[model samples]
Target: MPTKSNNTGGRGGARAGAGRKKSAVKEKSENGNPGGRPLEVLDIPEMEGVEMPKPHDFLSAEQRDGSELQAADIYRETWEWLKRIGCSQKVSSQLLERYAMASARWIQCEEMTSKLGFLSKHPTTQKPIPSPFINIGINYMNQAVRLWNEIFQIVKENCNTEYSDEAPQNDVMERLLRARKGN
Candidate 1:
């Protein structure tokens, strides 16, 4: 006679896991999803024909268009882009107006400076018509002034001479004169 194990209770239907085998060994529901709703194959909302990225995937660095642009650099670039687009007079006028009123106010300030006749009073403030633009990369331009300062500091620290001991200056009069004389 076979001995009846206390654990099985001599019945295999539920206790011995004959019918409860699946319950004992929990089947991970599709993706171990707790909710009844189906697990999403794609993270983003998929279109009729277009596919979406999976959960593990992400937008590439190139796909990301971030504001690496500085205010001054943007002012320069927008003007350049406007020029490249080669707008008609009506469109140009509209763009310039919109650009002044909305996107940037720098041009408006520049126009005012010229119109106010104070441009001559402040000779240093009067610059040439800002054209012949450079394609300065946004990433580089943001840190331009900061990098320039760092470079200047490096030069000041490293290029020590007798003049280095001289007092701080409003202008480099000596250097300016020498440069003018083609020294």
Candidate 2:
């Protein structure tokens, strides 16, 4: 059997596919296999001389077209979740804004991972893994989730107190009487 023809440096040029960028997965000749990578094709002028690009530059065109979601989206989504759980609008927005910086980081990281090549799926689950930029994104997401949970806990407790009227409070007269009696 003949080797395959060299592929052209089509869409995946300088930018890695951060979005759904399409690159020529393979090119072929009818006869036999042409060669190794782009540089190795032989005997065919049109098929030969094709150049392979750095794999890292996968998303340039994809980024240009279908960009990743902004960091604000995370806050928006999280706030939406809070609202569904009965948090007030003020509380929801506060939850989003509390970790604005963290949200930004999370967005970038998530985008990088999401936009990787289709074949670049994860080994364990056959899902895609994140790129280097995803480091910041993951960290940011974790921070926002932690902070959101913390604030939500506080709000939940407050709601319980206000609705149940179970918070401890000494009446003025009771305090005075108790003080006099040293009770």
Candidate 3:
């Protein structure tokens, strides 16, 4: 008697129909979702005829002392923000004073730099000449910039807001709370 042979090779047995079948009809939901839950539409009520309060007027009267003029708008806005952040009157005044001083120094540095550029020229060659005052002005400008940055940082820290272009989750208060929670 001849025995029956079993040859499971050449695209036979497990290899045949092992992949997914291509469906002729595309499956879809009644809400047009393709294999997910239906979209939700919320019915929000409209708030018509609600009068909003105007922002506080922070610009104060300008003061002029002979040749020097005070920037009332800058001082006013700074004072308003500092007050909103719960800063004391004395601290706010001190910060504003420092800011004004730095701003004045910055203006003076700009003037000095411009004057130096005009004065720094050779008599015959007409070439630009170097002077120590340029460097001094640059140093003063740097100091003023540093003070301005310090003031901004102080305000940002006290106000619990992020001034940089980072992600919202990286806020100072969020980080502090996360650290306190041992997250």
lDDT of each: 0.30, 0.42, 0.43
Q: Which residues of candidate 2, in runs, are more than 4 Å off?
A: 1-73, 80-86, 89-95, 100-104, 114-131, 161-183
Candidate 2 residue lDDT tens string, 117-142: 22355678977664555565557667
Model 1 clash count equals 0
lDDT (10s digit) by residue, model 3, range 35-125: 4654333233334443322222332223242334222333544555544443323234555655544444444444545544535776789
lDDT of 1: 0.30
The best candidate by lDDT is: 3
Model 3: CA > 4 A from native: 1-66, 69-77, 81-91, 115-133, 161-183
| Models, CA RMSD each | 29.5, 29.5, 24.8
Query: Which candidate ranks first by TM-score, i.e. highest?
Result: 3
lDDT of 3 at 18: 55
- Compared to the true structure, candidate 3 yields what TM-score? 0.37
lDDT of 3 at 28: 28
